[model samples]
Target chain A: MPLSEFDIIARYFAQATPGRDDVVLGIGDDAAVIDPPAGQQLAVVIDTLVAGVHFPLETDPYDIGWKALAVNLSDLAAMGAEPAWLTLALTLEQSDEQWLAGFSRGLSELAGQYGLQLVGGDTTRGSLTVTVQVAGYLPPGQALTRQGAAPGEEIWVSGTLGDAALGLRLVQGGLEAGDSAAEQLCGRLNRPQPRLSLGIALRGMASSCIDISDGLLADLGHVCAAADCGAALQYADLPLSSAARDLIAADSGLGDLPLIGGDDYELCFTAPADRHTDIQVLAGQLDCPLTRIGRIEVEPGIRCLEQDGSPRSVTGQGYRHFNESS
Target chain B: MPLSEFDIIARYFAQATPGRDDVVLGIGDDAAVIDPPAGQQLAVVIDTLVAGVHFPLETDPYDIGWKALAVNLSDLAAMGAEPAWLTLALTLEQSDEQWLAGFSRGLSELAGQYGLQLVGGDTTRGSLTVTVQVAGYLPPGQALTRQGAAPGEEIWVSGTLGDAALGLRLVQGGLEAGDSAAEQLCGRLNRPQPRLSLGIALRGMASSCIDISDGLLADLGHVCAAADCGAALQYADLPLSSAARDLIAADSGLGDLPLIGGDDYELCFTAPADRHTDIQVLAGQLDCPLTRIGRIEVEPGIRCLEQDGSPRSVTGQGYRHFNESS
Candidate 1:
């Protein structure tokens, strides 16, 4: 006989993570009770991943679970919140034990790394979809929001961008496989790091921050619109991995991908020009690469410039769900 | 051109609920930041409603939105928590403006009634699905959990049962509609009144409690399993609305539905036998009906007894997702 939904949850997900003291109740009840630390505000975010829409249908269940939580945590990181708890709503076509085990393991591993406890959720039979909501804590009045950017602030991004998009192409068979580069890009697509520590350290330094999930240009456009300002990107200074550089060199048409491709999960932020030394020191201390890619301007549109400081035309507005083409 | 995801959210869902002082930041950001009331524990719950699975494909978009949040709020009610905030993740087949309008109105109306603020969420394109996660607060050490029932405690339930199941049947064309009773039952199905006030009042009074989403027998079975006890329900004492009784009289087999059917969204709880008068007064004060239908027992299984104390056979263990018949 097939295991019942309750049985599946109990066997695979009930004990997926060790209990935390702040969790007054965890799983198996109508709701989970948590105690948030005093004097700190709570930051909450939700993201959903649908099979074939968010990831390839053939993607491993483990990667699906990992990315589901990873994406939500990245949102928290963008807000400079320390993740505390998460709840998952998983809709599966069937109660396959093997799939449940793999998904649970993947979800639990990342949750444990971030000190997050699986509090409460529902599991039902349907097409494969994963919705994760994470709650994190931030000190009072210290949230890093997009509206804080000011004109003339230096725009910065942590880690390399466009790797996840390259990985997506590799997965879609647009790029050849069987190379270390392909494997590395696929890893970035499947498990993009959240950059939580960098976000926390940049809280007081960066004027504003946002995680790059919907391509750098489009996401930067959000910061510009929020702050009522414009931005000028030094396209030459945009960080790229060696593999990405090699692929782009072979095919210059792929150059636009670093600007228009989505799913990077890297932080794009703006800071005052005088904070350059402080940011560099903080980056060294955190051991995360930080690159200045642009500067906020008084004008109100996003512009990418070449090495000679001339305007470069960029098409497309990142990934939009209801657009003709994502 | 269709509306993009961000446009849809801003037009339909961005101002769905009024701002609250506790919410430092709301929509259009990386995440929502909230200030939870000090010294209160937070109760979190998530539930998903898949079109054609949780509700009929032809169900009203308004009803779908109302029920999605109602069901999750019902879970919090069972925990004796006062709802504070919610996040929604909606998956849709297309950007249907009419559907979005109706759905947003339904959700916003209920949220306003409960003082719930829509904090943050995601909108994605996929099969029609709605996942709602609610966070409520409870006074310290006063949560009504299912594991607190003891032998000799009297079991109680709020409102009536089986109406929603009959509503489902009516919706499915299994029963004739077009009558006032049918409309009332269907209303119960479409918009369940979460016993939030009653649950808050029962915080320190009820020994154990659970919302009746999976029928009376099945949910009671959960309380029994959690408390390591059994239950004896008096069939005669089970409360029924006049409409349900009239229909059951015309079809005798329908009598069992009050026990086995699901989606009642009422609260079934246990309290000390000595607190019967206090409970009665509470019901009167809250203007809600409360019926004492059974008692916790030392035996290891659930049993139902007729008016003359003779054992009445009952089968089926409420609703179970992934079950062969469910």
Candidate 2:
């Protein structure tokens, strides 16, 4: 017997309710009901991942599901909000029970980890696409935004960058890596950890923040635009994973990928220079490195400089979703 | 210059946000910030419409945009909530400036009418697909749910049924109609009016309620399942538009189309028989017709009755998103 839409939702998507006190009504209704905490504003965002666009069509269903929710969580992390609820809209060409099982596992696992309740969503038949809208809450006036950076503030980035971009290259056969290193690179490309804890920790410390989804420069540009300032970065100071460093050593051409590679899912933030020790303590407490690689400048455009006080020449632009070649 | 994602959003999706006091922050951010009113719970839902699946691929982009948000409003109305914020995730195969302009106009018109603030969303490159997630607010304990119907309550529906289904048939050339009637029917199909006002009127009075997207019988089945009761409907009592009645009068076989046809976008509810006069007054106040077509029964399955007390059999099931033959 063919699985109906209802059957698909019940069998795979109807996860065990996490006993959320705020979710008054969850799945199985026309809409979910949530009683948000007092004095906390809701932060919401929606993102769509289409096959052959966000990820390779041949990517594992589990990885696709993980990445879909992970990216949305990253947005919430950027805003310094604790994830409270999420809704998924999944479009599939056909029903594959095994694929559904794997996908559901990946989604449920991440949702469980963060205490996010999968409150409501839709399942439809079409070309494969996954759209996730997440809701998080932060105390009124406490939520971080990309519009608060001031001149002379230090810019910090959580976690190493560019591993995911390299992972994509390795998986697509555009680049090659050794065995264990290949596993780590491909995993980075397939599964990114949202810096929720880091975001929460930097709530009052960081003046402005954003997630690195469209590479470092592009996302940081958003911060600059919102904050009405410019940024200057020491290109050599960008934190890089050993895997990415080795890849760049073998091919100097790959050195610029971290600057323009997308899907990093790490928080790029600006904080006062006096709070440098506080950020260092946060990094130690969370076991996540927070590196200061730049500073907000008075100018109007982003500038990349070498260690020797010389400008570095970069090639290509950041990822644009609408560009025909993307 | 190729349109960047940010450029597309600013030009098309960054609508003049309705002055919603609850929307602390709206478009152009990583996520939107909203503060639901105190003493109210949030009703949230997400829906997706794919090209050639939910609607014809040739349908106008304007109509597609309107219908995408309209259908989500229908869900919110069914919950007796007032819409507050919405986020859209649109994926397209390519960027067409003309199409985007028309779509944004249609979206802005409807959003402006309902005071729905377009908070934040994402636009990506892929096969045409539109996903909208809406958030509304209702009193914490006054939500009209599908589980509140009593066994002896009267079942009611709002507006006319089956017109959109007939419209689909006419448009697809499966059925024929006059030009004026065709235009009327097609308008009903493409531009469904979500019964927001009537839904608010029915809040305290309605025992159970749902929007009729998947035909009367199919949607009523959901009510029955949730209420733990059966339903008995007099087939001849279903409110039908003049165009639909005339079409059915020509061919008796087409009579069942209204019974199981989908995309009505009308409300189906159950209330006490004593509230009949109250509902009548509500219909007058809201300027929407209320038709009492059936009653909740103690049995386990839905039954259809002819005027002469004979059993009527439905020919086909309502539209299911995943049904291969639908």
Candidate 3:
């Protein structure tokens, strides 16, 4: 017998959301009710991933599920908020029980990692698409926004960049990577991590922050625009995984891969020059590398500088949805 | 110039959401920040409407936008929550300016009517799909759930049933409707009014409540299942618009239309018999009709009764997403 919508939700989606006191109701209701902590502002974000557009058509179901929630959690991480609840609107071509079980398990693992409870959403028949809306809480006036960067502030990024983009290229047969490196980079591409703890640590210290979903240059451009300032990034300072560096070494023409490639899900932020030491200590505390790559400037446009401080020419700023074909 | 994703959002989606004190942050952020009213639990719901699945492939962009948000708000209304904020994840095959403008206008009108502020969302390239997640607030312990009905309680529905279903049929050429009536029913089908006020009023008064999205019998069956009881609906008491009556009068086989028809977006609720007059007064105040069509029974399944006190045969249950083909 084919699994009905209710049967699918019950057999696959519904599970014990133990020890969540703030959740008054979870799944199996018209809406989920939650009592958000008092005096804390709720941070809400929704993101949609479509097959063959947001991801490749042949991607594994588990990886697809993980990436879907990971991207939304990245948004909350950028805001320096603590994730609490999530709702998923999943549209599928059909109900494949084995695929659903893997997808749900992937989603459940991430939900457990973040202490996020699956609340309520809809499941319908359609071309494969997954939409996730996540909610988090932050103390009043404590959120990190894109508008706080100022001239003379130092730009910093957590972890490495360009690996996911390189992974994508390798997977698409545009580049060749060694077996072990390819696996690592593909992991980065398929399962980008959300820097939740790093974001929380940077809440009071960092002046501005954003997740790098649209590559380093383009996302940093957003911060620059929101802050009404310009930025100068040292090309050599971009953090890159060994695999990404090897790819660029093999082809110098791919120098702009890290700058223009997206889907890294790493946090790019700005902090006052005086907080550099504090950031170093915090990075050690979080066991994550924090690299200084750029600085905000009074000039009104973003520029990338070469070894001699000469401007580098780039064709694309980032991945533009309208310009790209699925 | 072609519309980039950001340009489309700025031109069509970014509008002033004024005087919303609870909304700490609106659009143009990683996520929206809101300070939900104190002491109130947040009720959240998400629904996805896919092109060609939820509506005809050629549905007007404006109507598509309206119905997407309307269905989500209807879920919130069923929970007796005051609408607060919404985020839309819109997927489109391509960025069409005229279509986007009309869709935004439709979404904006409904949002304004319900005081729902557009927060943050994502725009992606895909087959047309709109997923909206809405949040509302209700006093703790005051929400109406599907599990509260008891035997001897009365089943009531707000507004006429089957109009939208009829409208769909007329538009699909399944049946013909008169010009004026066709327009009215089509309007009902495309622009459903979420009973926000009625839901709020029934918060503490009603024993159980659910929005009739899947048809009267189907949704009431949900109430029955949740409350662990059965329902006896009087076939003669089913409310139908004049157009629906005319269609049934022409073909008695269409008599089951009202019972099995979906997309009404009306509230099907159960309340104690003593509160019947109160509900009537409330309906009068809201300028919407409240029809008592059935009573809760101790039996374990639903049964439809004819005017002559005999059981009526029902050929269809309701709209099941898995069972139906687009």
Docking class of 2: medium
Ranking by TM-score: 1, 2, 3
Native contacts matched by each model: 0.83, 0.78, 0.78
lDDT of 3 at A298: 99
**What DockQ class does candidate 1 belong to?**
medium
TM-score of 2: 0.98
lDDT of 1: 0.91
TM-score of chain A of each: 0.98, 0.98, 0.97
Q: What local lDDT score does residue A28 receive in model 3, on the 0 to 100 scale?
A: 85
Candidate 2 lDDT over residue span B1-326, tens digit each: 56778878888887644768998989977889998898889999899988888899888888988899999999989999988889999998878888888888877778888999999999998889999999999988877787888899999999998999999988788899999889989999998989888877888999999998888888889999987889999998999999999999998888987778888999999999999999999999888999999999999789999999899988887778666553
TM-score for chain B of all predictions: 0.98, 0.97, 0.97
Candidate 1 collision pairs: none
What are the per-model DockQ values? 0.76, 0.72, 0.67
Candidate 2 residues lying further than 4 Å off, grouped into runs, are: A324-326
Model 3 residue B248 CA deviation (Å) reads: 0.8
